[model samples]
Target: MKQEDTIDFHIKRTWQSIAKMYNEEASKYDATMATGYVLLNIDKEEGTPSTSLGPKMGMEATSLSRILKNMEERGLIERRKNPIDGRSVLVHLTDLGLEKRADAKQAVVRFNEAIFSAVPEQKLEIFFEVISKVNELITNRKIYLKEV
Candidate 1:
């Protein structure tokens, strides 16, 4: 089969395109796609737990820690002990982080709006259904190769 006709190829290419677009927008605010994603996952008022952030963002612990460290150095976030758990920490956005978060939110909104405007409602629904099925299949390991 042609690469363009493969489901994985299309999924990967679409994601790469979306990541590039987000990275381009994030560069304006001195952030990367990952950083902006992390910023968005954080709670504006209560803050997010350090452990929860990685899982919620689908990021590795090490990658999340490095991003958090960079954000702290840039005055975008602050870490404090979780009130209920002495062994855990909570990540709260600084005022500057809030500003960046707003920007990131806007970028996301605009991107979604652009896509929504271009795609018909029915097609969009089907697209989401397909994506959900794909995710379910992957989660269940249904795509594994069979022995010859």
Candidate 2:
């Protein structure tokens, strides 16, 4: 089968387009797609644990560490001692980070609104169902089982 006709091909292509669009918007504020994502995942009130930030964002610790470092350098985030857990740090957004996070949130909201407006409700529901099932299959190790 041609690559263009594959399921993953379309998924990846769509994701790349979305990522590119988000990155372009983020660049105006000197941020990147990952940074915006991190900002969004962080708890605005109590702060998020550093250890849990990666899992929340589906990111690796090392990769997240680098991003967190850059964010710190930019004064977008601050790492504080976790009051509940001394061994772990909590990531809190600085004022600048909060502003950027608002921008990121608006961008996401706009994208979702656009997609929702463009697609029929029933089709969007089916698309979500298919995507959920795809995730379920992967999580259950059902995608690559050995032949009987």
Whole-model Cα lDDT of every candidate shown, in order: 0.94, 0.95
What are the per-residue Cα lDDT tens digits for candidate 1 across 1-148? 8998899999999999999999998998899999899999999999999999988988999999999999999999999999998798999999999999999999999999999999999999999999999999998988995878
**What is the C-alpha lDDT profile of model 2 across 1-148, one tens digit per residue?**
9999899999999999999999999999888999999999999999999999998888999999999999999999999999987998999999999999999999999999999999999999999999999989998999999998
Per-prediction TM-score, please?
0.95, 0.97
Which candidate's lDDT is highest? 2
Backbone clash numbers for all candidates listed = 0, 0
Query: How well does candidate 2 match the true structure, expressed as C-alpha RMSD?
Result: 1.0
Report residue 122 deviation for candidate 2 (angstroms). Answer: 0.5
Locate the minimum summed-lDDT window of 10 residues in model 1. Answer: 139-148
**Steric clash pairs (candidate 2):** none
